[model samples]
Target: MKPNASSVSVVRSVTRSAIRDVTRHLRGVGLRAAPLALALTFAASGGLRSAHAQSAQTAPAGQPSKAARDEAATRFKKGIDLFKETDYAAALVEFRRAYELAPTWQVLYNIGQVQFQLQDYAGALPTLERYLSEGGRQVPAARRTEVEADIQTLKGRIAFLDVTVNVADADIAVDDTTVGTSPLSKPVTVNAGRRRVAVSREGYTPQSRVVEVASGDTVKASFDLVERGANAASTAGSSGDTGSGDSSVPQTGTGSTSGGSGDSGSNVPWIGWGVTGGLAAGAVVFGVLALGASSDLQDLRGTRGVAASDLQDASSKATTMSVVCDALTGAALIAGGISLYFTLRTPPSDSAASAPRTRPSQATRAPRATWSSASRPQSSGPELQIGISPRGAQVIGSF
Candidate 1:
């Protein structure tokens, strides 16, 4: 309800008296100009809203009033004073209050500056961006350039996180702030240093990790969630731990054992290459042996004194060696090609296929069986089969 003109005058008189009291208190507090400044701020803010409205019956309500602007200015001044005193926390509160009342681009600039001083770089970045974009014409080009440069510096001290959960639609969060439900389309940019990551899905044990990242780095974390059970975990990848797995089994390769799969694992490719080299060496040895044998056979055939039966025997031995050499060479080529393929190809990720295998229940386990030496397949020690009949003893190959 609108106040009567007589009531407005009385309120104005009270406001004027209060301003005087505040001014005297400020002067006594040793800030000489504070009282006068505050009085001017209050008076310029149109004294009291109700009192002003009584005098200006035609004033519009939609537009911002002179009183609000004055109050915002007062808050801005107080924030500056607190900032000079190095009380950044108090300054931040005052700056925020000013911004709330005014919401001008200049007020946003002050808020961003205060947040930066408080070491809340993440909060400051967006605020500064808003200042540059919305207050471009109001601010000088040099000021905008400085803020953009500051933003770049801030980003340098920031990092990002990209999380992958084995279970689809699992809820995910970073630093206690919800990014969204997985799988996230992009990584979340955050301040540098240690950060907490969490993922949750109904019917499955939740997974979390604390990751430390340097400035400008992007870290990817995957969660191979386990179902809820007595053996299931309540947490994973805890501080100083390398992974988020329930099993304590030692990691055998560089590839992840969680929600993602690796290409043949880190060791497999190297092992394959080693095998390839070994096979190639074997092939070379065999080829050299075959060539030596062929030369010997040629020499034997060229000799005029050699017996025909002797020559035939040497020729047969040379032919067998040559065939073996060819086989070994072919084997080397095949193995090397496979190794090369593995080294070059990017392995497709298979979250399920890479999961740990559970042991069979005692009741469902296969029964143990034993076989006699003569009946069992020849796959034991030495990889060679040897037997002696009544006729004689002879050496034999495993094949």
Candidate 2:
């Protein structure tokens, strides 16, 4: 009368499914039972150890195959060892696997302990509560009270974020660290303080919010991400995913150019080149004036019976013009040097340098639009609050 292999497999599948449903129901509010709570749950249904005994008494030996039970026990042992080693993450995985096979409260307890050890208090709270609820008589009344008290104390230090997200499978991040996907099982627990929450998904704009929560308070942060204005025309031309197809990208180059030095450089730096050209022109003009005044002086001195006053006047004029010419020449040289330096030092904005280059794709692709992200609190209760954006620099520019 022993149950066959097929029957045992069927029982395990059914039990796993039932347990999963129960787990999901318990977690509908966003938490789960403690790892050890499985012991009580299993015991209430004729404790996990009593499972085979009940099966044997009802029918025959090996009702639930010994090998299967032994494997579950082995997994549980490994989980315990991992927990002792302070490898809480590994322990949780092992305990979960054991629960899948046997679905014991003890495994749940272990999982909860690991979560707590890992400082995932928000995740741990629900599981521990579940353990207590189902622990029933298996947990001593005094012990249950102690655990419940602990749960209450833990709640005081934690704040809850009940997030509402529109996009399915969108990742949610708390304080820049990815927490989980959207449609959370329950409110995410975090330390009381200012927290940043964000949600993102493909083909949709990312949404984020900042909120301040006092200890024991619950806040709402909801995300309704918008779909991108996907355009194939834009994607084909974009160097990166963010490129606007209609916009012409600046080509990068090296060295600088000045007026009349045409390599298709737009926006002539008149402030630099104009000064250089003007100073050079002034020097030439002054030199010509000085030479003419000196020539007049020579003519006045060479003329027979030339007046001393006329000669003296021409000499003084020549001297004055020469000094002015020399001063201008020096000024021109200095001005020219400064202009050359500035013209050669083209700012990066004007220079097309060895910037990262992107190629236009021939294949049709979706073009992104000017995307703006906003969030609000989606709540049915009075505690529901709107999304609070963190203080940030405002970027304003023309397209």
Off by over 4 Å in 2: 1-68, 166-186, 191-196, 208-212, 230-399
lDDT (Cα, tens digit) per residue for candidate 2, span 232-269 = 44565465644543244443332232222343233233
Instruction: Report every candidate's CA lDDT.
Output: 0.66, 0.62
Which RMSD does model 1 reach against the true structure?
Answer: 21.4
Predicted candidate 1 versus true structure: per-residue lDDT over 1-399, tens digit per residue: 466678667756755665565456445544333323333334334444443564454335664455565577678667756755667799789878866765566667667766776777877888889988887686677777778888998887778888889879999988888878988898877788999999998888888889998878899988998888633333342532644353455443323432333433455679888887888888888888888988999999888999999899888888888888777766666566555544544333454335444452532342222336674544342222333456533433332
The true-versus-predicted C-alpha distance at residue 360 of model 2, in Å, is: 25
